[model samples]
Target: MTISSRVRLICLTGALALSVTSLPLSWPNPALALSDIKDITPAPPEQDPPATPAPAPAPGDDEDLSDEAFPVIPDPDPLIKPSNTDESDATTPQEPAPEVIYDLEKAPEPVRRMRQLIMDAAASGDIQALKPLLDVGANQTQVPLQTSDQDPIAALKGLSGDDEGQEILAILLDILSTGFVQLDKGTPDEAYVWPYFAGKSLALLSPRERVELLRIVTAGDVAEMQEQGNYNFFRVGISPDGRWKFFAVGD
Candidate 1:
């Protein structure tokens, strides 16, 4: 035979031997036979396109990534409103400027004249200007409080005759300037307080004991003023005719 025919004959013999070797030699369980077993790894199912992430750019393609390939940032949400987080900021409602029930221009003639006298006496420490107002027509009896060393609330004029009388005058002026808020007569607090120094209106009281509050507050006004550093508000007590009974620093 020729070389080509000999080569083909040898290949055919090898394939027949391999096929015979692969065949089962003995009988086995029919349920566990090779034909009965299914493949554990089925041909890989086709992958879905949506599950894949977008490919990142190559290093050479990263030209000034900050400016060109800018990171996507979410914009502010439209549903929610921005809030003012600062506690000290002025955006919060400021205390409504205290309503001035009495100002220099709006005050009655008697009150205006009295204020002028007090101002002059306080400025010059001269009781002479205060003498006319201190007289009985004014219903002001210039009685000495005889309580404190300064006796600020002692009399209408305080100690205007003395050098430090300016202090007392200022206190009285602050009291007069305080706004008036009418007290409810039906209230039990107002009823119990009616017997003392008869006044129709209430002056905000900072003291605990309302019994001698009238006298104590008069003396305490000076201390309270010194402590506060400013006369922003005053608890004012006035009679039906508008005569001030006693005034003290209050809300």
Candidate 2:
């Protein structure tokens, strides 16, 4: 009689209708009255599906992901090593300094002297002698006795008179010919009289004969002769026969 009782009654009626609708035609054999169940047959069972192949494993799957995956390799000891790279030898190897060889036969007088001076300086440990000779090829302005229009080498040819003088002359010849002036000029304090001449007379000598003539003059002892006239500051004299002959000192 109330709203709750009415709702319950409607639900009961809907359930009864659904049950009746879903009922089979017969109680036990629903298709018993059908002509043939075989004629209305079900489809045959599907053959078992072909087996699918498993996918191949990715590379390095067996490798460990842990910190210990790859072993650390220590560097090989240098002492015991042979290498895939270039292996350096342990022996102390030396490279020789460049050497200059002199040909005594073909050597010009100047070259011979240059060699001799180098040898003598090296022997006596008087290396200062080497400087002047080395300067033999430089300009004449450096020579103390340099004259206007006079060739430096020729001037040296005119001066060298002894063993020391010859050495100086040789240096002069070498420098004049080679024009290679890469060394120092020795000081007068070193008593570099001959070597100094060689250094000073570089680039002045023009001929082999001039060198020979200079060698003769340089072989003498040099001294100031005299002040001949107003313009004549006399040094060592040249004779009419082209010899280096000292004259009166002050007359």
Candidate 3:
């Protein structure tokens, strides 16, 4: 409460304020200050590097891959696999092949002699020469004519382009020159037909047989006959008993 005591207290307070003001103001070191702060933010999530894309394939690579995945199959052999054409159908009925005989000695004596006589008459180039062989009877030689009652010799003349009937003679010679076939053996219908094609199927001919057919007819003619399924040309037939059965044209 005395003046002197109060003055001393004031002086002591002033000295304390001056000491606080005179002291240097220093900031904390920057690196040490940041380290002092609490790390509240969550650490960034761990991340993987971006993946690289695969390279693209070159041209034709897809085809090469496909070939490796599925191999190609080859076609079957033709000999092993038959075609399904109608001509080769197994269900179709085939004609029985006739026995073609080329050697004249195989024929009976009567048949051989009669054939030779006919050949001689045909080679003579005279239609009338055939009249004697064609007698009027039940066993008489049969010929293609308009009427059954017509005279065989006269009918032949009418058929020929020339009056001498040389064309008919040539046709007879051509028909008898080839091979012959025996049909319906030991039966009343049995006969030896000239130009074996008369009793054989044109479709079933061998290469050599086809050549024989070509000798008597043209390729176009043979093709047409094949379509018709038989030989259609001049033919001569003789019975086993040596009788000249027929000289005709047609199936």
| Candidate topping TM-score | 3
Q: TM-score ranking from best to worst? A: 3, 1, 2
| Each candidate structure's count of clashing pairs | 0, 19, 0
Candidate 1 accuracy as lDDT: 0.45
How high is each candidate's TM-score? 0.27, 0.19, 0.60
Better of 1 and 2 by lDDT: 1
What is candidate 3's lDDT per residue for 73-109, written digit by digit as tens?
Answer: 8876777766776657668676678889999999998
lDDT of 1 by residue, 141-236 (tens): 324445534333344344444554555555455444333333433442221111122232124434532333344245475456446543323343
Error of 2 at 235 (Å): 39
Off by over 4 Å in 2: 1-44, 52-113, 125-128, 136-251
Candidate 2: tens digits of C-alpha lDDT, residues 97-148: 2221223433345434544554465355333443544333332123334566
- Listed per candidate, the RMSD to the true structure in angstroms reads 19.8, 22.8, 9.5
User: How far off is residue 203 in model 3, in Å?
Assistant: 1.0
Could you tell me which 10 consecutive residues in candidate 3 have the lowest summed lDDT? Answer: 59-68
> Candidate 1 clash total?
0
